[model samples]
Target: AQPQEGEIIGGKEVVPHSRPYMAYLKIKVKDRSGSKPSSCGGFLIRPDAVLSAAHCVLKVTVILGAHNINVQEWSQQRIHVTDWVIHPNYSSASLQNDIALLKLRSRARINENVTFISIPRSNEHVRVGTRCRVAGWGDTSVYGSTTDVMMEVDLKVQNETLCQQEFHDYQRLSMICVGDQNSGKSTYEGDSGGPLVCNKKAHGIVSYGPSGRLLPLVFTRVSYFVPWIRQQLRRFALQELPASPSSQ
Candidate 1:
């Protein structure tokens, strides 16, 4: 959906998290008069890697340290994108397995402000009502536009049973739901593929919308995709090393 003006529409307040580990992804698209460069939210997984929605990375120059409202002001870091691996089962229309991993040309320097978040282990269940954090550089106002600086919000977990009931057939085991229908604040567009962290660990990746016209948000559970993540990490690790002496 397109961005609109106004901070809180229908009583919802869009803001950033206090201590966010997320980064704004400024995608440099084809230069067109009247067409702004596309932007999305993402987070560091390892010093040399980034995690974002597959759809966000499709044909774009990713710039780290981007903000939500000031595209021109934010500093563009090193241009480094060796490869992008989208989940094999990703479906654009359905937003299923909509995650992607980005390998950088060089490792990102981790400081107090920039660091990787821990991924939830396989089968790790985050119970309903648990507080989880969602961060992004997406729009603060509904239909407004994406921002240059990152923002975050706190949301409560929704159980699988309720998620199934709400999403029905569209919901997959890899997805999880969060937020309160009554709460006016929740994640929005451009937040897809960002992390849903709890207890300082990434439990899910922002995937779909609020389900109904007025509901919460849905995410692809990280636990269900732990094996895939490990496999990717292993592949990346192998590629990083030099040939063994015996092989040489």
Candidate 2:
């Protein structure tokens, strides 16, 4: 499926650089005309790894430690993606297993501004009605202007029954239903591939939403793919290592 871009709707500007784990994705997609510029959100998981939605992957430049994307902030660390691993079972139609890991060409500079976000344990679960936060630098409304600074909104996790009603094809294990339907708060275009943070741990990734920027957007659950994440991260590290020197 052609997934829509995303952003934070009805959100407030977070304290500058407060979310240390936040990653700004500058994507360039080549087409018939030429390469077009676009954006997405991701989070640092390791010194050289960023987690995001698979569909958002393209020719990506990962920016860390930036509040306003338009500015040349000193805290920013821009790096190109050398490699990436998308879930093998990701289904475009259903948006299942939308997670991806981007391997940076070099390790991120760890400091006061840039850091990694924790992930939920393999068996951990976020209860329904739990309030969580999602952030991005996308538009504030449908066809609205994109913001300069990063924005975030607090949304409550909805029950599976309600989620099933909104989305007939909801996947209980791999996907999650988030956002408040009545509050007018949501993730809009430019926000896809961002992290859904709960209790400071990454729980979901922005995947897809309805055409109208409808409520109860779907996210790729993180906990369900913990094993895959670990495996990929380790494999990438292994590949980056130089081959063992010949023994005497």
In model 2, the clashing pairs are: 5-189, 5-190, 6-188, 6-189, 6-190, 6-191, 7-188, 7-189, 7-191
**TM-score for predicted model 1 compared with the true structure:** 0.81
Q: How well does model 1 score by local distance difference test? A: 0.67
Count of residue pairs whose backbone atoms collide, per candidate? 16, 9
**Superposed model 2: Cα runs more than 4 Å off:** 1-7, 242-248
Candidate 2: 10-residue stretch with minimal lDDT:
1-10
Q: Compose the digit string of candidate 1's lDDT tens values, residues 102-208.
A: 88787766654456788888979888889987776555666564444566667889766766776654565777888766666667766666788898888888776
With candidate 2 superimposed using the best TM-score fit, by how many Å does residue 109's alpha carbon deviate from the native? Answer: 0.9
- Top candidate on lDDT is 2
Judge candidate 1 at residue 3 and give its lDDT. 26
- CA lDDT, every model vs. true structure: 0.67, 0.86
Every model's TM-score: 0.81, 0.92
Task: Please give, for residues 1-248, the per-residue lDDT of candidate 2 as tens digits.
Answer: 12222336777889998899999999998888988999999999988999999988989999999999999999999999999988998877877789899999999999889999999988588988899999898777776767888999898888877778777668888888887776778887788988999988999999877666468788889999998988888788678665743221
How many residue pairs of model 2 clash at the backbone? 9
